[model samples]
Structures are given as C-alpha cells and as structure tokens.
Target chain A: MSEQFEMVPGNSLITKTPEEGRQLAVKMARLVIKATQPDSAIREKLRPIYSEDAAMLISVGQVVATEFATIAAANNYWR
Target chain B: MSEQFEMVPGNSLITKTPEEGRQLAVKMARLVIKATQPDSAIREKLRPIYSEDAAMLISVGQVVATEFATIAAANNYWR
Candidate 1:
C-alpha cells in the first residue's frame, strides 16, 4: 500500500481555518483508505455490509478521529 | 444517537468546488460516526483496536465512499 498521501494541484490537508481543519481531517482519512485499499469497487461492494453495521460504522469514526487528531496537531489544536 | 448532522457556523457539506465536495464527503462520514457512537471516551478506546486492523480501516473507506457518493449527487457528480 502507498504510504504517501497524494498531493493534488490545489487540494491540501494543511488547513487555514478550523472549518478547513475539519475538511482536511476528512480528506486525510479518505487518503488513508485509498492508500490501504485502492480498489473503489471493493470498497463500494463492502459498503452495504459496513454501512448498516453499527460496530463497523463506529470503527469508521475511530479512523476519522485519528486523522482529525493529526490535523489538530498540525494546527496546534487550532490554536 | 443523533440522526442530524450538526450545523456549525460557517460549516456546510453543500459545496461549490470538487475539492469542497471531497471535503464534505469526509465530514459527512465523520458525522455518521459521531451519530452512531456519541461517546468520545468509547470511540477513543476503540481507536487502537480499529487503527491497527486493516479490515476495520477499509470499512472506514466504505463509509466514506458512501458519503462521497451522496456528495457527488448533490454536486451533480461535479459536472
């Protein structure tokens, strides 16, 4: 799996505002998913299974929280 | 659990750009997580368990994809 986050021409995870911080957190979380599992078809197929499962869905939150933490750090917790 | 995604001031998932579409998709995913599991302590506790588990992480991707699809529709698939 690719360890590096993709850098689009104008897209970035480094945010300038708290709102941007939230957006970047989501973007980074998706990047990790893409890096870990590049297959969109597989992800789509698994969606029905995971989306309805509360445990699986909460697990998704856990991953997003982790990404948000990293973004929070980068923004010095948005200080 | 709350069914509504919180509407913070100056924050919205209704986006104007493809990049914003991506950002909103992620934010929506996170909102689902927040709604599914409202407790921060429990989510934090489960973080380590999900973060190291590939299946769990991919599940996160699945959820994000679902949200992205919704955002795509709202943006007319960024036409």
Candidate 2:
C-alpha cells in the first residue's frame, strides 16, 4: 500500500486525553490507508514511487502495524 | 537518517490558520529527525530496521526530502 498523508502534530491535540488521541490516531490511519490505495483517487500523490518501507509506514498509520509501535508505546499508547 | 515520530492529525490543527499549521509542521519535522538520530538516544525505536524507503521518509519528514511534498503542496504548503 502506498500511503501519503499530511500529519501535523499540534499542542492542542497532544494535550488531549489519551482516549481522544487514540481516536484521532485511528481516524488518521484509516484515511492514510484509503488514500494510498490505487482506487482511492485522492487526486493528490505524494511521491512518484512508494519506497520499500512504505508498507511499514502505512500499517503504522492504521494502528494495526506495530513496526513503529514502540514510538506509540513510549507516548503511552499500545502498551 | 532514521526517524521515528508519533504524528496524530486532528481537527484542532487542521482547522488552524495556515501559518500556525506551517509552523507546527516545521517543528514536528525537526523533532522527528532529532528523535530518529542514533545519538539522540530517544530510547524509543520504531522499526528495528530502516527500510529502503526509510531515507525517503526521513527526508520527507524533515521537509527537505519532498518525496511526499505533493501531499503538502495540495494542502497549501510548499507551493
């Protein structure tokens, strides 16, 4: 899956409750996965080609792939 | 450069003024880069191995790689 997203972390969201942050995380991941699909037709492409690690990033976005789980765990999610 | 970051998109930042969003973008990019550096010792590692696409992702993150710049361009940045 080739996923391209614009994630801008802000103080407001970061300060939110863990539950709120978790919800936001799940939503963002879904959008990213959908956007990356060939049929998504988002009309906006990030890179001409998806790299070898694109899959890892896409899964991480969706909250299912744990390649980057430690990053989330340290922040108090996916414990 | 290997970078691990926790970026959560939300309505709060998305609804903010472009200026604010841009500032946040730059800051987030910097933090991700710093966190990924081996010497940074952030103590949190996302993927045990950086993929072939890791470089692209890292550069995309620091706002210098631009592999995913089009995503930003369409959203009203890097235009």
Candidate 3:
C-alpha cells in the first residue's frame, strides 16, 4: 500500500504523559524543519553548518525544550 | 530576492508573552500540517473534508488548544 501523508487528527496530546509529550515535542521540532525546508538535498547540505555551530545546536534544543514545556502545560503539568 | 525557507534558530519562545505564544502555537500546528503533507494541492483538497466534519474540526481546535495551553505554560501561564 502507498504511504499516506494525510494528517490523522487526534487530541491525545491533551492527555499524554510527560515522557510522551517530550517525544512529541522533539518530533514537532523536526516536523517544522522538514516542513519549512522541503528540499532534502539542501537540508543535507546545511546540516554541517548547523552541526559545527554550537549556538545553532543549542537553539534547536531550546525549540524542543519550549515544545516540551508547552506540552507539559497542555497535559496540565501532569498533575 | 529569493524567499528563504531556513529556520532562523532562536529561543524567543522561551521569553515570549502569552499572546505571542498563542500565535506561535497556532503557527506550529500549521507547520506540522505543511511539513507532513508537503503538497499544497493535496492539502487544499483535504481541507473541504476536514471542514465538513465536526469531529475533525474539533480535533483541529483541540490541537490548537493543546498548543495554546502548552505555550501559556511555557510562558509560565502568563503569570
């Protein structure tokens, strides 16, 4: 069967645990990258520049951390 | 000039206000959609189906709500 690229809508994030939220946070970050830059070849070319930049790497982590914090809140701080 | 699709690395989300966070939350949700589909024509075609389904629309809102809540938390619930 052909792979489906459609968005399968769900609200599991509202009830997900922190661990799951963390995973999703990272995934969302990667999704943004892929979405913003659909060209894989260019992404591959730019990878080295980012890998070599300490600040860039840290910024990426920060984005993921931000996502994590937001997800944690959506899950009601897992309280 | 060519439009750049590069992700400008930043940690602004960590310091943004609730209003800004809300906007970003919605944006992130859209980014996921664009990233996952990577085809404008397909997205446009799928839009009508999602728009007609109440549950689908609610799920979409829930995703945005989850994002909003997460962003609010990241902003310390705007405290």
Candidate 4:
C-alpha cells in the first residue's frame, strides 16, 4: 500500500488552483486520519498520553492543516 | 535560525523516553505555531480560504498532533 502511494512533493499544493487546493487539503486530512486511527498499533502506544493530551493533539493538527492551506493560497492555488 | 534547528528524523521521537516524548510534542507544537502565525506572509495568502475552511484546519491539526503522540508511545518514549 505504501508503494502505491506516491509521496507528495514538498509544497507542490501551493501551486495548484483553488479547486486543487481544496482537493489537496481533503487528501491530507484523509491521510492524517488514517495514520491516527484509534486501534492502530501506533495509536495504542500513544493512547495513554493522548488521553491526557487531547488539547495538544488538536492544536498540532490545526497547525499542520493551516500550513497546507497557507501554501495553497500563497501560490494562488485557491481562487 | 533555520541552521540552528536540525531537522528531526522521521519517527525519532518514537524512541525517546516518556519525558522526552512530551518534550518533543511541545517542541513540535511550538514549531507548528510559528509556521502558522496569523500575520505571517504565508498566513496572508492562506487567510481567505482558511476563513471558510476553519473546520478542516482544526481537524488536520488534531491529526498531526495525534500522530506525534502515537509515535511517542509506540517507541516507549513515554511511560
């Protein structure tokens, strides 16, 4: 599955059209969600800390998405 | 300043002690916040779309943080 997924080049989304920007955001969101699945082995390891650090998790996630969106707009990827 | 900050290797935080995991999360949070500063040039480009995409941004941020925390626990970086 990893082989099937091509790595997105750094900041490439910044150059896409507005429509493309939204699409890219959606794609990224999906990927993040998949990586953080509750039952995943990674999640199990992280769970105890996460239970106490929910606020931090949310803040970090917001930053990541914000950066992507910013890259999109800076490059005029969005209309 | 960029030269002073070494790029953290992928998943290095995962192997850190529990205390180290918390430190890493805090560090990552700070970095992300700096990158997404509201008045930064990048933010200016991203603002309009973000105004409409606030939910997405929040969601994405949560995911990134969650993944980091997961990595921390998976590697026994956190107790």
Query: Judged by TM-score relative to the true structure, which candidate is superior, 2 or 4?
Result: 4
- What is the C-alpha lDDT profile of model 1 across B1-79, one tens digit per residue? 8646583313655666545665566566666667789888987787656655556776666665556555545555343
Q: Could you give candidate 2's per-residue lDDT for residues A23-58 as a string of tens digits?
A: 544443333333223343321242334334576456
List A-chain TM-scores for all predictions: 0.73, 0.36, 0.73, 0.41
Candidate 3 lDDT, tens digit per residue, A1-79?
2223322125346634544565566567766776677777988898656544333433454565567666666666664
What part of the reference interface contacts, as a 0 to 1 fraction, does candidate 4 reproduce? 0.09
TM-score of each: 0.48, 0.25, 0.45, 0.31
Tens-digit lDDT track of model 2 for B3-38: 344442342234233234434444454455565565
Which 10 successive residues of model 2 chain B have the least lDDT summed? B64-73
- Name the runs in model 2 displaced over 4 angstroms: A1-13, A41-79, B1-79
Give model 2's clash tally: 0
State which candidate, 2 or 3, has the greater lDDT.
3
Candidates 1 and 2 compared by DockQ, better number: 1
DockQ of 3: 0.04
Model 3's CAPRI class is: incorrect
Report the lDDT of model 2 for residue B8: 28
Q: After superposition, how far is residue A52 of candidate 2 from its true place, in Å?
A: 28
Best by lDDT: 1
TM (chain A), candidate 4:
0.41
lDDT of 2 at A5: 43
Error of 4 at A38 (Å): 9.2
